[model samples]
Target: MSWTKVVAITGCDSGLGWAIAARAAREGLVTIAGMYNGSDTEAARALKNLCAHPYKLDVTDSKSVTEFQNYVKNVLQENPKYKLYAVVNNAGVMTVGNYEWQTPQMIENMINVNLLGAMRVVSSFLPELRKNGAINDFKPRIINVASHCGLQALPCFGPYSASKAGLLAWTRALHLEHFRDGLSVISFIPGGFIGSSNLTMNQVENGNKMLSHLTEEQKSIYEKRIRTLNKYLGQASNNTRYDSLSNEVIIETFVKALIDNKPKQVYKVEPWRYKFYYNLLKMPFPDIMYYWIIKKFLAFPDSE
Candidate 1:
């Protein structure tokens, strides 16, 4: 019998993770979806209907990751033909606020999930992936779902940006470390999908939490700015104009990163405007121009 390719994806509860999981199943790969919310949700039911294996996975918990790893090991043991082909580190969370406004827990949560979580999953599964690659004489890819904010930090996305930047750096280092082992590690920036994803779903809640931590004097100074930031974030999350590409478009780039014979170190799916702006930043430009453009684009409140 021929080898059957299998893929594991995290954050299958919603958004890009759900879309990508569905697409991967349709592509004839045996998909194992890791849903944080477990099998109770509509997404889990839908994935089950698709014949994809959906399991409760909490990347933040070491025990949960180990359990998920064991589950994958069982699948391989049960189906000898099955070879772990790829692992998609898609689990991530985000919040919006100025750096000072963000709480310690908020920053820690982003780092724990976006950066350390991916690291945990990768470290847990690398042995299996490397073993499969060696035995099957085929390369297995590790696709990290990164963000454009990682490339250029935005004002209200301090923690989120830092997390993604760390993820990207780790991706680069891992890619080099395992290149000769027939393991492909890369980062995929899904670009601006604010309208479609649950990334900024808790903007208001986060804003409230941030505001509660401030002194009365601090609150008087920062309340308007925080409110402005929250309003802008809400609008951006709801506005289709801010998110140009459909889920299908984003997943197509993801598929390319998964199946390409010579995949790039980074696969970025972004709008033309973002492409232009990012390119412009690469040129010999002044810092003021870049910040000015960002201030206008994100509707940042004026400093006192």
Candidate 2:
């Protein structure tokens, strides 16, 4: 295998995935962007412009994953001069509200796409990495994009937080298993709110529809949580001119991980204060009390 840095990223149609793919391409790394919406005009245009080869990869579909794996394998086998250097499992969907309100399918989708999807990509790409390893140019890396929610149980973000928390554990386990395999594993946790890209307004709209089945009291409590959360999300989305944190942080961090001689296992973006809440959740007495006080005000269903 030839030693040219090539990275495979899932969910490259938008958000941090898109941002990271663009950055990797700009850095002259051969970037394979696997996106569910690759047929979309915006994705097409960007793929063309960035020289990013776009693959229609639905992470939730086993067939699609197999196809992607075969395509990558074929391309590398034909060349034998280039190999996949990194895989970014960045495809994710966010869900809001309490666990009791979430349907079985909704919860399953979150777990499948956000958590299981990453596992699928890692497994599929392992063979290629091992092949490259035989040729002495393979220093495989896997970066899983988790969130601050992974570290803590927020008042109403049941599905999202649970999935991410599972991902965090999964990545840590992978890191422990392959510490000597020259496989650099990074689980990136971006704290606070980051602006959206591929996850458009339509997601929020559809999510609201799902919650529409709730009773008036449940709806009232849900609305209160949304009102508080929306304040932060809305500000991040609209107020770009005012200290807006870019998704580019994820791209840069990925690059650093790829290039660094000894990359750290976990990168918590947005700093200490934001990371505090997540760590606080792991604490004993005060942590439980802290979350209880906030949930008390939100008037959770249990309280009612």
Candidate 3:
């Protein structure tokens, strides 16, 4: 009795989503990848000849989500003999702004696509997962893609960090709920910025556009905040680089988590760390307190 796993993933338009779907298909899983940009996205085009199926889905839209859910249900139902193993909640967006500087729409977009989207996908797909539990080989699982920023308080990247924090909390709570029901939940947290991914440049670009629409006083405040963020993100860029191993390595972890006889509750790795810098963040002390105090000094001591 051979085993075949069918999988569904979101955010296949690029980055980790593209890498995960491509690797899963390469490893012989039936992979259905959801992309907001439909099949014509560059990420979809690159993987079009690959074994994965790129379906159009905007996680923020209830109608589109419902349609994709139906598509997955039909595919799984019509092939009842196969096991539906994993769904990777990988779709998300990032926004950079001081709380006072951010617009209502920007806040809503970040919260919707990053936090709400994950829950929406999980809620939509659970019935199909629950249906597979009776089969001997069936082991349904959910993997939420979170970030190290979720664990730490990043200075300038507030919305992204908050979203990941929400995801981490959600993953932890949901794991408890589904553990006894024959389902597995894992949170995959990747540390540091990886190359070959969208660098939140869209948010920066949008901020610049919005600057023209603001009143003179509002524009002045936004410009200063934007400069602060631009400098920080630029500095971080010099430290992070992604090699093929970063993508392959993370995907390999995903594959192992999917099939492991005893999968881990959480997977955390920094593909480019020369030392345990992330560990240093966990250091109890005035070490972190002093660092933040100095960072605040550099950022805006006058405001204090």
Task: Tell me the spans in candidate 1 whose CA falls farther than 4 Å from its real position.
Answer: 235-245, 283-286, 299-304
Winner of 2 and 3 under lDDT: 3
Q: What TM-score would candidate 3 get against the native?
A: 0.84
lDDT of each: 0.86, 0.71, 0.73
Error of 3 at 93 (Å): 0.7
Q: After aligning candidate 1 to the native by TM-score, how far in Å is the CA of 39 from where it should be?
A: 1.3
Backbone clash pairs for candidate 2 read: none
Ranking by TM-score: 1, 3, 2
What TM-score would each prediction reach against the true structure? 0.92, 0.81, 0.84
lDDT of 2: 0.71
Q: Pick the candidate with the highest TM-score.
A: 1
lDDT of 3 by residue, 1-304 (tens): 5557889999877667777788888888888999988987666766667867788999999889999888887777788665678888989887665655666677788789988999999999887676665556577789999987788757655877888999999999988988777777889976544445655546556566556556789876567666656555444334232222245666777778767766788987665451244555566758668476536433532322
Error of 2 at 75 (Å): 2.1
Regions of candidate 3 where Cα sits further than 4 Å from its true position: 1-3, 209-225, 231-246, 271-275, 284-304
Best by lDDT: 1
Error of 1 at 84 (Å): 1.0
